[model samples]
Each structure stands twice: as structure tokens, then as C-alpha cells.
Target: MLEDLKARNPHIAIYPVSDARFSKYGKVLDGFDFNQCLDIMQTRPIPEEGNCYVASDAELMGTDVAGELSRRFYAGMPVQIGYCNGNSSKLNALEYHKGSEVDVAVTDLVLLLSDIRNISHNELSSESVEAFFLPANTACELYATTLHFAPCKTSSDGYKSIIVLPAGTNAGLDSIPAPKCEEDYLLWMQNKWLIAHAESIPASKGAFVGITGDNIEINY
Candidate 1:
């Protein structure tokens, strides 16, 4: 895929995260210290305005979505036993840890709702940018401190990842309120809080600091 990206000259990385193994407790093998980011699939509607934005800071931008490939294709899940992929709809949303920048990804299904359309990718040879349409139920982990885009999730069951980045790291901006013309279009927020720099990672000054079962102040 990397070669394909290079041949296509998109100047992007399409690394499919090889399953690094899940922990005994079943959490996906956690390692990167990059800032975490995620959002819950909006399950309910705004009680105040039936069609308008609610004032609550927590009003979500999501809906019921799940893997559409489960019925027909080999929606692989490396972490599971029987199938390559699990009930991805049951997978958790995007997440980032403290001290890391959040990486957002997105896709468009409303564009494919009719099943007769094709996603448009504007490819180039220079270091420009491109968008993605993560087939529903697909989740990816960006390498530590890697620059990526606001992810596009079309699963009605919702899709996301919680990120954990270096302390004091600058993360990309919230993707909910992208510019009017940019809405519904997957974009790599180049200047937001989600993007991070080497200086922002945990100071490799003394020892390593990691999260424990309960507390966070402990240092290793």
C-alpha cells in the first residue's frame, strides 16, 4: 500500500496497523504516548431544538453507525479468534491520553448511501493532502507523534479513538466546527491541536512516566 501511495504519488502514508497484540485484560495493546482523541456516536437528539444545535458543550456530532461490510466482505479483525474483525460497531470511539495530541479521522457515507457512487480522491505528486473514507468498522492507530488528519467515521454505530500524547503537547483543533465549505469533507487539520511536535512529547529528561490502573502521578 505504501508503494501504491508512492506510485499514485499522493505523498501520504497508508499503514494498516498490524495487530500489536491485545493485553490480558483485553484492551488493545497500548503503547504510543501521543495525545488521545475520541467522540461518542450521537445516539439521541437535542431535546431543546429538534433540528438546531444545543447549547450544551457535550452535544455530540454522531449517529447510529456500524460496519456495513460484515454481511458480505471479510471485514477482518486481527484481535479476534473466529473472524479477523470483531463486531466493530461494538468497538470504542477515538481516544487520546493526557500529554498527547488528538488525531481525528473521517469518512463520508452519505456520499455512498446510494451504493452507486465512488469516493473522490484528489491525488498529487507533491506533499499536499488527501482524505479518507474508512469503510465502516475500521479503526486505525497513528504512530506516536505522527501527523495525520481528522478521521471520517460513517458507521451509524459511531467510530473513534482516544489518544494519549506527550504532556504539554499541542493537539489539533476540534473537528466539529470545520469551515462551512469543509463540512462533510474529510480534512487533515494541519494547524489544530491534534497535530503535535517532538518538543511536546513527554520530556525524556529523567525516567518514564506512564498510566497505572488508578493513579497517574507515579513515575517510573
Candidate 2:
């Protein structure tokens, strides 16, 4: 399936986490016990077609890993535990926040990434996007400048990963002050400024839809 994907999208190349390009943005976490988090994921139901779950702050009352992450990685910055599990392939949108995000891959998956600095006028060229392969049972920190969204499944079983971020990263944005500029169009959610491809589902939901180029889809 990977070979087929490459054949169709020459620009799309999946790199291992150890690649130097990844070093500039994130790193793999060694010696972390992800069993407890994976156990909780096994209890939830992941979607078959697209990303379906996201708890912006599951750590508040969810798992012990959250506290561990805060103390060890977040410097006690009141982190939150969340999860994104689904069977998705398209690069629908790209979003970023004020700080780094840690992702524990309970299952093998592919993450689409791009440097937020490449975006201009609230729009980003798809040509700048890249794909990175995240192996199962590994955790990595994605820096704030990295634009990313859901993990694409590498197989039919689908993908499941634990997401760690600052508290209230994805909370409701109904109370945010009104948009004042073009960049504000990307503020669909709190702490998340998004640029969605026109063909993406979020575009229909009134997302900024500032991404230009084909809506990338990974072959499974």
C-alpha cells in the first residue's frame, strides 16, 4: 500500500521518526510506560472512515500518564491528556497551538506535518507538507510550529494515539473575541488556528479553508 501511495503522489514520502528532518521539530520519548493509556484506548470505539474522538483534557480525570507527562516533559505546566483514534487518510486540515504536543502511538500511524511559518496570508501551500511514520508504542513531541491534525491509519485496523497538550487546548471557542483579521479566520477552536483544504469536511463546517492545492490522501 505504501508503494502504491508513493507511485501516485511523488511528492509524498514517508520518513522514519529518526530522520534528521524530524529532529528540528520533535523527538521520540524513550522509557515511557504507555500501557495504561493504551488500555484505556482499547475500551473506546474508533471510527472507520475519519477521525472521531478528541478529548482536549482527558488527563483531568482520565489516566496517570497525564501527571507523569506534566512532571517530566511539560515542566508542571498543567498538561492535559487526549486521544485521537480513527481510520483516516486525507490531510483535511492543519492546526497548531502555543506549545508543543506529545503523541503516543498506540498503533502504527502516519502524521502529516508542515512548518507553520511557511503559511502566508492564512494560507499554506500543500507543496510544503510532509509525512512522517510513527511506529506503534512510541511517543514523540511535536513542536508548536509543526502543523498537524489526525493520524492516518497504516492498516485497516485503524489508528489510535494518545495526545498530550496544554490544558484547554481544544476547548470551545464560542466566547473568543470576534475575528479582526484574515488570520482570525483560522481560529475555529481555542488554541487552534486551522487551515483546511477546500475538499475537507471542516471546510463545510465553516473552517477557514485556506489551504491551497489537492487534498492529500494516503493509500492504506
- Go through the candidates in order and give the clash count of each: 63, 0
Quantify how close model 2 is to the true structure by its C-alpha RMSD in Å.
2.3
Best by lDDT: 2
Q: Which residue segments of model 1 deviate by more than 4 Å?
A: 1-13, 19-144, 152-220
For model 1, the local distance difference test gives 0.23
Q: Per-residue lDDT tens digits of candidate 2, residues 62-118?
A: 577777877888788887777888988889999999899989888888889999898
Q: RMSD for each model, in Å, please?
A: 19.4, 2.3
Scored by CA lDDT, what does every candidate get? 0.23, 0.82
In model 2, where do residues sit more than 4 Å from their true spots?
1-11, 56-62
